[model samples]
Target: MTIALRDAREQLRDRFLFWATLALVVASTASLVTGAIALHSDAATYAAARDQLLALGKDAAAIAAPEFYPLKLMRGMIEQVEIMGAVIALVAGYRAAAAERGRQTLALILTRPLPHWAYRLAKIIGGMGLAAVSLGIVIIATAILLPVVSGIGLGTDDALRLALTWAAGVFYLTVLFTLGFGLSLWARSPASGLIAAFALWILVVLVAPQIGDTMDPDNQVAGGVFAQLSVPKAEQDRIKAGFAGYETFRNGIEVASVTKHFERFTFAILGIKDTYTGAPVDKVLAEKRGDLLFLFLFSLGLGGLVLLRPINPDRLTKES
Candidate 1:
């Protein structure tokens, strides 16, 4: 616990990490604010139209009031975290291993009361705590900003769903942190380890997400292809069934992307996906479980790799 606390505090005081967290908050806040403004405007327009219809003697009760989902407004928040959060994890991991490799500490800790497994676990615990608390600030900001931006407060269910999405973010961040931590420990130099982490981040967080999104047939057209063409659900399924092989290939690529899984799981909870919007919490969980599982597997795999290292003090030592 002490080590964990120390790890977190060091991160809090880190100049690079401070700026990264601030950037994440500012960027995501912008996204949430923009989405909220759009929603507020649309709702206002709908209300005005409804009022005009009623003034003309039309039944006002027949028209539906606009539903404002504060949680859905968090789509931008999710994106910011998806990109920046991974970078933060990598940096944190690089620092954690680097700290242990210091001249005064490496030999003593690796050879003393702290076994390599215990040392690795403590670092991970500390880093995980750091990731959680840092990323958690985004949620707090969302809660505080949502009402102010959208003129709507979060409902209990909305709050719960947002919490679930935030948890997914923490999990996603943790997996990346583990990756960075493990890779740095294996690399000959901390700088190389950090670079390697960023390379994978580019592949998974940046490139892979683009590949998956563009390959999505629905996304081929603005506002979704099927919706744009006014295709019925049954027919849409039929059309999709005809391209089973292509879809399988696309999904295969998406399945390989940690970013896509995080986005999928988060989007479903936030109701960003029209199909999942207004769907019961249980339904969202059941359907999105696969994506969450992939993230969990990443955490597991990276963690195991970290733990299984030979525990050599020489490896943790710096090049002389």
Candidate 2:
């Protein structure tokens, strides 16, 4: 507990955490504003078109009023998490390990009365605590700002979905944090850890998705390539089914990317899945079980790596 509190204070004093938290808040606020404007414009356009058709003596179905879903409004915020959130986690982890080494405290800590695992647990707790603080700010700010901007009240389901999205964000960031922590443990210097961490981030978060799309052109854009070909949905499905093996391979590559899992999990939880929107939370969870499991296992795997890291006092002394 003492070590955890000290580490937390150290992290709080670091400028990076403050800046990252500020950026998240700003990004979330921007997403809410952008979503509200888009929704209102869409509502207006639909209403105008409906009026035009009715004036032409054609029956038009009444358009439903746009409902403000806070989670939906946070789409951009979630993407920022995929990018900046990972960066924050990487930086935090690297700094934690690198700082100990640079300050020559690593050997002293290892020689302390406390077990080595306890020190690691303190670091983990401190790093994840900062992450939770940042994510909590994002969630709370979004929840408060969304309804104010959209003038729509959130129902119980919306609150639940927001909670679920928060969980996904925590899981996603935790995975990235541990990845960096493990790398920092292995790397000789903070620079090396940062480089390796960012490289993995780029590969998993950016390149993997692009590779998946390139491998299966149908995934290159939204609505599938068949939409551009003007094929019916049924035909598109049939054509895609014909390339089942290739599609499976492509999906495997993507699923292997933790970033992809995070995005998919967040989308499911927040009702960004078109077919699953307005569905019960249970349905979303059921459909996204694979993604959730992948994220959980990935996090545990990295954590295990950290826990199993060599704790030789001689090595620590030499490194320090």
Instruction: Name the top TM-score candidate.
Output: 1
Off by over 4 Å in 2: 41-70, 228-234, 312-320
TM-score of each model, in listed order: 0.90, 0.86
- Tell me the tens digit of each residue's lDDT in model 1 across 57-142: 99987788766666877788888888878888888898888777755476676567766777788888887887788888878887
RMSD of 2: 3.9
Across 64-99, the per-residue lDDT of candidate 2 in tens digits comes to: 545444467677888888888888888888888878
Model-by-model lDDT, in order? 0.82, 0.78
Q: Which stretches of candidate 1 lie over 4 Å from their true place?
A: 44-63, 230-232
Candidate 2 Cα lDDT to native? 0.78
Best by lDDT: 1
Error of 1 at 202 (Å): 1.2
lDDT of model 1, residue 51: 91
